[model samples]
Target: MSCCHAASWLSCARLVQRADALRIIRRVPMPGYDVSFLITAQHLAGPGARQQLVDWLVGFVMECDAEINGLKLDINARGRAVATSLLRSLAF
Candidate 1:
């Protein structure tokens, strides 16, 4: 048995490009093992948009049969400053 962990960024395109990107790596086949996924997002439109993104992320996670152990979202951030802030907040 093997365990696989993956991380990806959710974009506004409503697509799971991460899965496609991971296809190459998943071919190895983990038998009777747990898979973990960490997904992040930045610049979600608004509450509604954020919900939509969450829904898409949930579906993507289920499709991959991976447990979402963590999430790092950087909402309403435009550049490096906001990213730094988010990272700082998470550190504490």
Candidate 2:
């Protein structure tokens, strides 16, 4: 599930946790619910910057065998840009 808003993202996670708890009560085997978040700067300007960033992100995720649940991009009035990614993975 991809959420454009932070509130929705958090609520979605809560719902998953609740389902997991219900499964536990019924003694059903539950899969790992591990989740990770990555936040980093996104270059807002310069030629080919966006393409380069997308390539890097795709490569990194593929190499780690990670699943992306959500992505958020924000730019402030001061021209600062940020990217946030929600990743899900099996518990180690």
lDDT of 1 by residue, 39-88 (tens): 34442535675666566657765644433333222223346677888899
Query: Can you tell me which runs of candidate 2 are displaced by over 4 Å?
Result: 1-42, 66-92
Q: Give the backbone clash total of model 2.
A: 0
TM-score of each: 0.27, 0.27
Per-residue CA lDDT of model 2 for 1-92, tens digit only, reads: 23345545665555445434322212322355243323234352558855655655454446334223322222342233222222223333
Predicted structure 2, TM vs. truth: 0.27
lDDT of each: 0.45, 0.40
Candidate 2 global CA lDDT score: 0.40
